[model samples]
Target chain A: MSDQPTPTFISLDDAAAMTEGTRVTFIPGLQALYSEALKNVCFVKGISLTRALHPPMGIDKETGEDRQARLFELTSQTSLPTMFHDDERPRNVWIEQLALAERVGSPSAPALIPDDVAQRVEMFGLCAVILGEDGMVWNMRIMNDGPLSRKYGYNKTASAAAPAKVAEVIALIDARLKTQAENGSAYLVGDAVSAADIYWATMSMCVTATPPDIMPVTAQNQGMLKFFASNAKVPAIAEVLTPRIEEHQHYILKTYCETPAVLGGDPL
Target chain B: MSDQPTPTFISLDDAAAMTEGTRVTFIPGLQALYSEALKNVCFVKGISLTRALHPPMGIDKETGEDRQARLFELTSQTSLPTMFHDDERPRNVWIEQLALAERVGSPSAPALIPDDVAQRVEMFGLCAVILGEDGMVWNMRIMNDGPLSRKYGYNKTASAAAPAKVAEVIALIDARLKTQAENGSAYLVGDAVSAADIYWATMSMCVTATPPDIMPVTAQNQGMLKFFASNAKVPAIAEVLTPRIEEHQHYILKTYCETPAVLGGDPL
Candidate 1:
């Protein structure tokens, strides 16, 4: 119900052409969890970001080689959620982008990293565990990717271990949320919302199926979401993904993030 | 095998009572991948470490409460491969422990972290992907833990997704190793053996079953190894666990680490 203007999605050419201000190139479809998390951080911090769609890295038909996007020239990696601010080095890593958002955002906004040393350490550690290299979403990605790849008859096979790992991560988050609730805090790390909360709220899309009313996606993306949800319904994941976790995602999106997520030009 | 002295495993009480140099408490039996990695780091660095068996945290019969070990009080965590050096804070995290080894280790030893900034980043990033929270072994651990738990009729259920994740990690390692080999480097990162090499070499135990002759474990552990190996033989894992990966483990243990491994009371 917030009246925030819909984020305008621009072409990769326009994004690369503009050498001023903060520009973020993100993949706009179902696999937009990382992009969404970064956008939500900017949203909470009131940091203006020029949104651009990541160019597809498809094979070059004539050359018989892989086509490299202009984005790859800017950042060696060909991944979404890459941020470029002013003349600074492009930030492809999630933590670095979060740090950038914190650095340039409005001073009046809630701090993503807590002031207290202990809370800061806890926040960083939890964020790393949730969003870092081998963190929760990373594992969930493996779990989901394996089945998706196999279903398409790709050479890739699924890991029998990913679901349990996903479950373990869910259990950890649920337990943390429960403890925070018990301590009279609505957020993940401390009293106010932090990067951990945003990361969890958006990344939960990897596991939980968000209805169209809350997060509208194209029909193709809807099928993808269904696939992810079905894969996530294993006993290991099911046993720990408590209702509270889902509610927290809803609360974070409704209160802090742009509701009815304006991803990939979905109508407001 | 090198004539290096067998590492004497001390009792938990003796280890706790020691007020001395570097002391490492590790789970002795089958679940010793973490311990093995830490121990190998010390071995490569030629740092003397007093080995201690971590006290089990089983439930008490009369109180029906989970018994807390002295280790838990020191580190606030109930896991293996906890390192204590002098009066410094106990290190429960893998990266922290690696840093400790790098700090107190011999200068003559092959540096685990690369000297060049780019190589260092690659090494750390790869190490994280392998040993970090959701890295390779972590996913494999989930893969292995699921079936083991289910087999025992524990409250846990297996994730249908873990095996593919395990395979993906294996493919990553295999590809890295292959690239390194093709580039004429014997190790994972650069020309020298770095922490990345050691981590991949030891952590591969989670996926590849080491024979009793190479690394002697208890008879009970042998059974557990069998269970792990059987679970790890899925199509996903099988497709990627190339011979090169297995050979690297043997080479590291034989050339760098003390072998046959002097774990628990198993005579060398």
Candidate 2:
């Protein structure tokens, strides 16, 4: 076999082969990484990093160090998830991979993550982590648990962290992405697409759908929409996700969303 | 002839092609843009831009936005191009482009520079700008006149005020690329290559050659090497740019240093 054309490891990057084995650039498959006693699974650790770059912990380019020092004091008091540990169990593989990458110097570069870029990358990494940790499992969760959570979920909201307003979430994403598209700057920056864009895009699929026309879309939305609608999920969930959260939403809507619908499949 | 297919625009990614133009992307053509005069270039102006973000400015992750603030202030202090025109020569097209990009919003977003991926895009853009500005013509002057005097050259020493120590410049770029490569982070940030990496690679080539084995060797080197070796340059330029000073000299010596001698075409 070694002499005769050994099968080289090749990761597919196309629409049809959704299989986890396929090396989806910028996308990782959680199920493939998990087996029987799946522990130490890490995901969404960076979702909040973007916001973290805003105040004290994050250096404000305008005010200088004094503002950073003060911001640090404020953030220190708050219970923020600078580094989030997904779920009750630890996904050993991710930890091992991270360690191995660290040892091999193949993990993402911490230095490359300049102050601003770090915040953006961390947030995006979290999005990737979540997608990798759960993959379609998230879709299943939304399909199965979403409606039940939404229909009976009502509680008194108090304090500042009263969960993000769903509508605001959508609008925020819309505004950022719209600017990104308009400015021709990939992410929030000049010409590069930061982790924020990727994270938003990935996590976003959990809430909304990619546009079909210029992005990754498929023939799956019909039934998928019905499934999501019937389950109805959390109102916040619906409120947070909308039609054009990211320019790529159209792509997802067109590609992945439609696949299941054409196949007459449901979230389950 | 008119119907010769609407000439689809493809993305060129090859280092050389991207430096100039290829299939999928059209960059490195900043020189061409200068010749073509891209009008009304809508752009996004980023507030907290940095070196990894903008090669022209170098890195500035400091909390005190003093440096960038000064840069902004300098621009504000004087009109575009420092308004030192002799009331005759038509404005420098390259400067016009830069000013135009800033005016229209930066031709792109808030985070115009992406967080991670390939580092070549920004470098690529800057290369275009440098080429567009006919930086070589000025560099040639830097070689002959040093960093002083008007007849010394055209265009402010791009980095005139903040001239990098030859060794420091070399070390900085080498370290930047090496660190990124070691991390498997595409050596640049974004969905693809950034102009920053291209700038480093090209500039580095001007100073020294790498191990042909390590770096894909091409005949384009001879012309480039000869250009730098010409006594018509900076003493620091020659000293720092010599083959002996090359960080990858051994890599080149042991691998591809002389391999190009056997090749035919120019080391473009």
True contacts kept of each: 0.00, 0.00
iRMS (Å) per candidate = 19.2, 18.6
Query: What does candidate 2's lDDT look like per residue over A1-268, in tens digits?
Result: 0111111222211211232211111111111112100111112111111011212234467765543343223222111111112211111222222322222222443211222323322333333223322222233342333432232232333211122333334455565557767877445433443333333443444444323231222233344434434432556555555445544544432332222111111212
Q: Score the docking of each candidate (DockQ).
A: 0.02, 0.01
Per-residue lDDT value at B228 in model 2: 45
How much is A261 displaced in model 2, in angstroms? 11
User: Where does model 1 exceed 4 Å of error?
Assistant: A1-268, B1-7, B11-17, B29-31, B62-65, B144-158, B266-268
Residue B254 of model 2 has an lDDT of 31
Give the alpha carbon lDDT tens digit for every residue of B5-67 in model 2: 111222111211222211111112121122212211121232121101101232457653333
Per-model TM against the reference: 0.50, 0.24
| Per-residue lDDT of candidate 1, residues B79-129 (tens digit) | 677787776556666776887788789998878866453355466656655
